[model samples]
Target: MNKYFNIAIVTALSVAITSFKGNAMSDLSQYVDPFIGVDGGGNVFPGPCVPFGMVKVGPDCGGKDWNAGWDRDGNIHGFSNVHVSGTGGGCKYGNVLFAPITGNLDMQDYSSPRNNEHVALGLYEVDLKRYGTSARLTALQRSAMHEYTFPASDDSKIIIDLGSFLSSHERQYLVGSEVRIISDKEIEGYTRVRGGWNIGEPYTVYFYAVFDTPSDDCGTWKSHRVEPGKREQYDTSEPTGAYFSYRTSDKQKVTVKVGISYLSTGKARMNLSEMNSWNFDEVRAACVSRWNEILNKIEVKGSDEQKKIFYTALYHSYLQPVDKTGENSKWISDEPYYDDYYCIWDTFRATHPLFTLLTPSKQVDMLRSLLDIYRYEGYAPDARSGDDNGRVQGGSNVDILFTDAYVKGLKGIDYELALEAMIKNAEVSPGDDERKEGRGGISDYNEKGFVSTKFERAGTRTMEYANCDYAIATLARGLKEKEIAQKYMERSRNWQNLWNPDVESLGFKGFVWPRYSDGSWWSENDYSVFQGGTWPDFVYETFSWELSFYVPHDVNALIEKCGGKEQFTRRLDTYFSHEKWDQRWYMGLFQISNEPGFLTPTLYNYVGRPDKTAEVVRKTLKERYNTTKEGIPGNDDSGSMSSWYVFHALGFYPNTGQDLYLISSPTFEEAVIHLENGRDLSIKAKKASDKNIYVQSVKLNGEPLDACSFKHTDIANGGTLEFVMGSKPSKWGTVGVENQL
Candidate 1:
């Protein structure tokens, strides 16, 4: 764990009903790391936007290469309120942050040489000659919490420059508010924009802004400032900067709050009213309250620091997929319908599943949105629902996710409609050439059936099979198509093709058999091999070592093939005790850094050596997920990685995305989940941690728990789990793999 970052307790438990933040903590605005989404990498943007929001506050430092927020060389561009770092589409709104020393507005006083502009927690200081101001910014969510001790100058005030709206969805109307005493906060107005691939309905946004100190031109209405030669049509006054009166003082303290909503101005006003003034104490209290309450939903008991890491990461995981459409269900993207976030094609995997635990309403809306996409576009959203679908991030992901949710009991989606979408999706693979009766793509179903990775294609293997099974199984279960389900079940076993019989491992040599056109083949070689450098030690010419252990549905099959339980036990030992191969591919070998490998921990159950699984679970949870830039190994793919940590920490993982959680190793000694239903799943782990990875014994509901698969039924009913843990595996739970088979 890096000492630079501290793990602080969340403080309270209150949902943000009236306001985004309830009580103890600050507003969602406070905890948001604007820089998180910076092109620093991936879709990460280091802007002022709330997590995953389009309203990013950073510099105009020219695209990504020039850098943002900080980079103040002559490369130093002006600041903008809305921008995306590592992403698509043009920028929308940009409200520049500046300290004005009463002047004719200067734009080029900054330097060609980048200098001190280091941003961090509670601090955002910079030396800028451009605006003839040395500025610093800070925040606590509801309140901007700024103490910008600008250099002593003549009459001056920080400018809330509405240079541009991040795609016109931004509304900047000047309103009069006397801070704590004012009633109306926003300038009764809104801006409109469209989103999504085919261009769905446009959205109108209303926003209310609050300032800490009383302003001179309080009530007078001001129009939005537009730059010359601008094309978008709008009724607005030319100048965009909002001016307030104040004399430059040493370390002057000021606060600001921005309330945004897709509803009418009334709703936006309500948001401001609910969160009045820039009261740090009040807002922080509210946010903290909401956090604590939701956090308590799954109460975690462990070292304060570890708890912080878990909660913080968990917090980040749920930051987006926000309730943007409002209660009535209407939303617009900067790019309009063509890029509406409502589409489920992308979120199903990492996004939707994580939300299933806390934000079901949002999940409902998402499903409805997918339904809308199909109704309007004549197609259920798949991999790339935008300008092109062939842009394969893998389309089957959505189908698999739909099946996962349907089986898990989410209501709202039309069964028939869902079936049609799912079946149509399955019948067609993303890139297939030949078509069949049921299959949607060009290739016949046989060629794509579960087979060797060389045949099915590695990246396309797991999900294709998963979705095929999903289509058949969902059809069977929803309408009793058992034979179809059986067919898919057989198809799902295609993962077996990747399993090499001779080497007794997942893939021995031609793991690269199906190879690709880029010559990149099946394995990763160098650091830049994959995006984000393979998420920790995920880099594998073949597969991350930890990932190779995955075979969730048929661990016993793997165990039997590896030789009996004792021999399988030896192989397991070899896995846990092995070192990196020194080759570029085997770097860090722990597959925990990858996705397909996520289910590896639960594999121990099929083999009968549950304790081994538990020990590794404990170790990985401790070592791999430390709080640092390197904290999580992979794309976070949304929250899959964190969810993995949370579940494993609690002692089990779902074997299927459905109502079946297989008991696995746990980290926390005592973890309790306060389900929304008033039921509580309490886990008591005695002697658990880095040293105590093995379980000496286990007891669920006080019964002699012999085997290791815990059902969702047992957990949802809410009960106690007690595991006597130690550093060494207990012989009692050491059932060999081969014998079980």
Candidate 2:
């Protein structure tokens, strides 16, 4: 039972446990609940996407709201082909919408009441109330297949609206657009959207749409006029496009296969080659198979709800750093091209490491993609979408992501080129042309040893820069570049510059505070009430108090600086105790809601007390997550929060920029991590249950593994890690492990 229990039995059991209405070969994809993050601030797009595929075809709510597409209460406004899952603010990329109707053009607002929806890994369907039509959808790598069932009527029509965007931000970004009917069954177009995080860079997405059956009467339209026999349409007054009216029987299905590309309309046509046929059922089945193949990488044997939560998180995890390199890639290289990196600031903590564990091959391609971006654009992108860089969030943190991949020994990337990009990004400041590219305050950080309060997000920036420097140094050491390693390793300690040792409040000394360029502490105001609003003098999205514990690469050094183990323990206790655990405000103090405070709960493992870590981890698991529509605590942040849950549930967490995993009490009795290297790492907990949440002892390969942690290499090599569970905290993992870092 310690091993993977044979593939035949697993397959047989999987087939037995699932029975769906459609022709789905595997049932694993069914466990993924698309609604998990819809209500929560998870902000995830519950759409049809094949793994990291670009085209996320799903419905957008009518009107304008922050939830982008498909808010729980908002009316359904048809399906669109592009979206950013789990992000903050009003971002771009919900282009080219197609809505089906069966009535006269009396009401243009097809904001129908949604009902009887079926959402799977790569499938979505919802009944539109007013028209009594059902919209079923699926997708390929870069294409969307929509099958809209209409009632018996002569006015049955398919509307291709180019200006139907997800939010007002996307609409504002629309510079220009063009649509043309190629033939009776074919149409081609492009939309150019700028700003909305892309600044002045306009993103032109080309599309090729083909209908299965030709319409009886087809014509193009712009603004409010229905242009009969007009073959072409350009930018008009308001949200413009065309409509195809058809005489139909009851339950008539109008199918359309649409392909999108950032390169050209030809590339979009090339992408549509994956469809091969107009069989909607076949496409949906194929999508289900592909999703199952990816989701079954990690198999768990838990309750139905647990499996739902686990698979939903797993689904969210693969939503991005989308694979832009396909058969019809925009770039002229064999190396993989990945785009829509919402921001490494959110994902560098856990999401990237989750990829290392489950999809190392993809991780390699992602690293190569970053390097490729550097090769073409002259600087690595921060929050990129639709083939353009967005606004820079924090420090140049792609260095940390690259470093994480390199240390984990993921292959296929050019290390020399990666090292060059990392060093260049760290040392050089971006020119005016590339404002959101390389490190911004590098000059001040290098000279003054800290970004002053004068700079935006000064405290968080200093800590993030230090972490990035540490990662670069680690990569340099791996490549045997001794000089580069030494240079960056020294610079990595610059986080110490922000420590305000004189602040002794609430029995806790040595708080990290903001400082002036003249080396004086900017400690005149209160930081606990949150900054950057009326004050306009604080870090980004977080308080300095929360940002203080962010020294991930060198927590031991942080512990020593904060007056050793006793005082450090007191501060950690105070941080957690000060705030009441609310899922909404996971941003407040030990904010598990976001990335800034991810490593706080596990800090106890470093201070020779794994029991406290166990307590907090269990409490968070119990309180924070569920199987509700609003399951996730906050913004999934492109799966960062979901990945955080996945790792913690499986009983380990990757220390960012390092190869080590800090172990804790796992939620499941047994979990088999199917490694991409053709191996399986099984974790079995004896007497595991809700009550038995404390680890009594741990054994790696039947040996007493006294260390409360293990290296990434240990799991990759394959073995069983058995943890004995108890109802109460014991002496297990209390003393600590030497040289673990």
Candidate 3:
């Protein structure tokens, strides 16, 4: 093992051991079901991966649902070493594929119908019925170990397909590939591919593979021709791979270890040192142990079903924004490097904040990574993968993520550089590739104070830009950049510039209307409240009614603009009523499935209707989420949906880019958050049950909490947050309503 990897492993093991010693080590990984969202639009990858590890070794179905590559029903095409979990849209990764075969090597008919499939925290197993082979997969940080039990066959073979990747429904195209057989038992190669969700630049994935048993015959193949004597293969667009044929007895097990890196095949070979021995069980055990360490950070008292849902959500939340600390081949950075932000627009709402609270150290590393990317890449990403940034959604949501870490006082980040990045995002236009990074329509947004109708998703852009400005303003004020703070704070209210009071929706007087550069509103004929199309729509992925509720930093103003508390409260109620739900667009006014509506259920807290917030939150939790293959209501969005569940289940929700957490009902009787600062924040709900979902009273640190909100400072050092729950709504937080914002 390399010294650096050894040190990292030792440090990680020491931390896990210490945490195990500090707390009672329950087998928490048992509650995590990796398959919960594999079939649903959740698009979750059901595979073996350590928390935030680079290698997600899983099965690919080769279907259009290739986002995570595997669906519950499709045939197992192959097992690939990298995948994104719980993300939607175009797919990326799924590189370095390996498939076991028998008899004639017909690539076209090589896929097998899987049977006896199983998945857990760090293990995935399936029986490939066609080949009568049982494949078991496990992983460490950067490598994967596959154990395949093959039936008696002289032509038992393993194909390492360099050209194979998760494609379909996206624009993934292979740029080039090179494979060299090192020996009968080893091979080294790399694949250069471009275009996925991000429309990313061609990124090379280098890999090294080794087998425990040597093959009798090994050669290379391109497209349809298999060259028996050729030891190497290089190709641009044609399918290219290497095959090793072996004689095997019935139930003979063959183990293959593969390591991947973005830097080089040498680094990929070094990553194999993560698993020093060929003990697949040891790696699986270590992976389980690491998962236990993460899942144990927050212990909860609930039913097995609830625990399954909660812990699985927690598991999914840690699966992405992968920890590629020393693997950045793009630029030299000692600051921790991470990628597959997969887009911060989805995660900034809850996932990043959850990190700020539970895993502050990792959160700090991620923040540093963001700043470092800004340092080298000119812009911090809204969505990024393959060491490049692109496919920005809304404004630069990284501004919100950074401000969130700032307000919560996460350390080890250069706040000055962070502010500079935020300023650049606000002031600079991305020009041609604005869809990929930074803000689109920045000229009109800055000059006219609103994203004009000329821009697609203009209304949504205007609102998100306002939120990003608010985030910038918040961080600037804290850093004593008073003039910059004042400028952005005033600019933060520019969402109001898009508010056309004459435009009514669902009997509500005001909605954010798309405005032209000349400051004229788009005619009612030109737009619809349910402008539900994506990319080219007036709003992105949601209706104007939904985006209208998205003014998070200034909800008081939003409530006032919607005709005060009473009318606003009724509007929110009507949103959740489901009367206007349209299957054609998934157009429920309050879309629990999507991120835009994530905070709407809790908006009643702003109106001093904590009871209403509790009711809506609990209802959404009960109805929209469960522990099943199709459990998640929508795409998990790189754990964004799961983190939403994690927060609401624990009885609080974060207002991203702010220090505040809005109070709600708890599903568990007790939830203990083990903070990185060596303190435990315990949330206890008296009579917390399905029936008793309303908060009757609350106390923080034994003192009465009059409002339905609390700052991060209140729990940063850890304390008990006690809630008295009852079936009936009480005026517990109604009196101190002004404290919400």
In candidate 1, what are the lDDT values of residues 159-212, reduced to their tens digit? 443332332221223222111113322233344443322232344444445555
TM-score, one value per model: 0.68, 0.93, 0.96
Give lDDT tens digits, candidate 2, residues 68-177: 47777778877889887888666567789888987765436767888887676666888898898889888988999999888999889888878666565534456777
Local accuracy of candidate 3 as per-residue lDDT tens digits, 1-741: 011223544444444443544654777877999889776688998999988999999998847746998976778889999999887788898898999989888867688998888887778888998999889898989999999888999899999888888876677888888899999999999988999888889998999999999999998988768898689987656768898889999999899999999999999999998888776656776887788888988999989999999999999999989999999978887899999998798998999999999998999999889889999988988988988897887888999988888888888889999999999999988878778888999899899999998988898899999999999989999999999999999999999999989998777899888887788888999888777757887888788888899999899999889999999988887777756666432424678778999888778988889998988889888877889987888899999989999999999999988889999899999999988888999999999999999999999999999999899989999999999999999989886345323
Superposed Cα deviation of residue 675, candidate 3 (Å): 0.7
Best-to-worst ranking by TM-score: 3, 2, 1
Model 2, position 146: C-alpha lDDT score: 91
Ranking by lDDT: 3, 2, 1
Better of 2 and 3 by TM-score: 3
Q: Which parts of model 2 have CA positions greater than 4 angstroms off?
A: 1-26, 63-68, 106-108, 168-172, 198-200, 235-239, 326-331, 433-435, 526-537, 580-584, 737-741
How far is each candidate from the true structure, as Cα RMSD in Å? 8.6, 4.8, 3.9
Q: Give the TM-score of candidate 1.
A: 0.68
TM-score: which candidate is best?
Answer: 3
Worst 10 residues of 3 by lDDT: 1-10
- Can you tell me which runs of candidate 1 are displaced by over 4 Å? 1-152, 155-255, 261-274, 327-392, 410-415, 429-447, 450-458, 461-464, 471-475, 496-512, 515-551, 554-588, 732-741
**Pairs of colliding residues, candidate 2:** 586-591
Residue 577 in candidate 2, Cα distance off native in Å: 2.0
